[model samples]
Target: MDKPTRLIEFESMLFTRHTIPFNARKWGAERELDRSAYVLLSRIQIDGPLSISQLSQAFGLDVSTLNRQTAAMLRAGVVERIPDPEGGVARKFSITTEGERRLDADRARSIRSLERVMADWTPDEVAQFAGFLNRFNRDIERLEGRPWPRP
Candidate 1:
């Protein structure tokens, strides 16, 4: 296939079809965080406390949308508002202990699911795919001028 065509198909499968994560939360686990919470919690866990403005800039979302998401997270008891560490005018959101636990559990579950799906693949194959994905993600982040924190 041509390059553009191949890229289009890859995007179709990865996003439109949900091939990679395959909606892991629905596969198993009785208590599951919704997609927005999972992503927000992961971001908060990585970056420490973040104001709504920071979150908006990081995700390219508007403040109103973030307000709703953060409000929902507050109600879910996954995040708490705190005085900004820098004593800025805007308060920031910090992940609660429950949020940390839930995020860890959810990531573990997703990894287990990936393991099951890749059970037949060789270690080298897995490593190569992972490298490709990381590179792809990094390139996109670079183009978008929004580098994601990695550890």
Candidate 2:
């Protein structure tokens, strides 16, 4: 097959595979956080506090959209706005302890789900798949000039 044709196939498979977990109704029911909240909480936990403007830039979302999202998170007690730790005047959002607990629980559930799905796979196969996914994400981040902070 031509490279272009193979790339198209890959894209289709990617989208299809990505939806599997989301389509799992049982898993979805177990989630306390929605997609946007989970992503925002994870980012805050990893990158430290961030202003709405910063998050907007990072996610390519508009400030108003982020404002609504953050407002919801605030009401849920998942995040709190505080003065920027870097001595900036603008307030920044930080994940609350509740947010951390929720995120951690969700992460554990995701890992367990993945483990169950890959139960038949060899350990090396699982490791290799994870490595490839990480590499793919890093390459995309590099191209976008938005490298995520690594632990």
Candidate 3:
């Protein structure tokens, strides 16, 4: 009997491989902040100050994991915890001035990386691709029962 055919998903593999190298370079260049720290900072920058619980829900991480992550961020002076002022038992976490600086640097680095990758693509093509990527993310979120921006 012939051997069973193997299924291939080149697109998934290609994208995953691309990110592995991209994030490796990113993490290597910015040794002060690990990838999770960067991601948490970025989320705080976008979502504003939020309680640990809120962050836990958003990231789907448990409280203990978030607590450790936040503690490291606090020690690095990247984030500060303050009273929620919204009637919460737990304090809220906000990006510190240093965090903003780091975030800006990271954003610039990311832009440079993207520019290098898309140097051959036209602005129109980039825009279309970005739109498709956004839509794809939204669709995935929907499938996972997550809320996304309304049209």
lDDT of each: 0.86, 0.85, 0.77
- Residue 151 in candidate 3, Cα distance off native in Å: 14
Model 1 clashes, total count = 0
Score candidate 3 by TM-score against the native: 0.81
Better of 2 and 3 by lDDT: 2
What would the per-residue lDDT of candidate 1 be over residues 1-151, giving only the tens digit for each residue? 8999899778867664554343774556444577889988889998999999999999999999999999999998999999999989999999999988888887888788778878999999999989988998899999999999986
Give model 2's clash tally. 0
Q: Per-residue alpha-carbon lDDT of model 2 for 1-151, expressed as tens digits?
A: 9998899689969866664334445555377788789889989999999998899989888999999999999999999999989999899999999999988887777777778778999999999988977897899899998877776
Residue-level lDDT for 68 in candidate 3:
96
TM-score for all predictions? Answer: 0.89, 0.87, 0.81
Cα deviation of 121 in candidate 1 (Å)? 0.9
lDDT of 1 at 118: 85
Residue pairs with backbone overlap in model 1? none
Model 3, runs deviating above 4 Å: 1-9, 20-32, 148-151
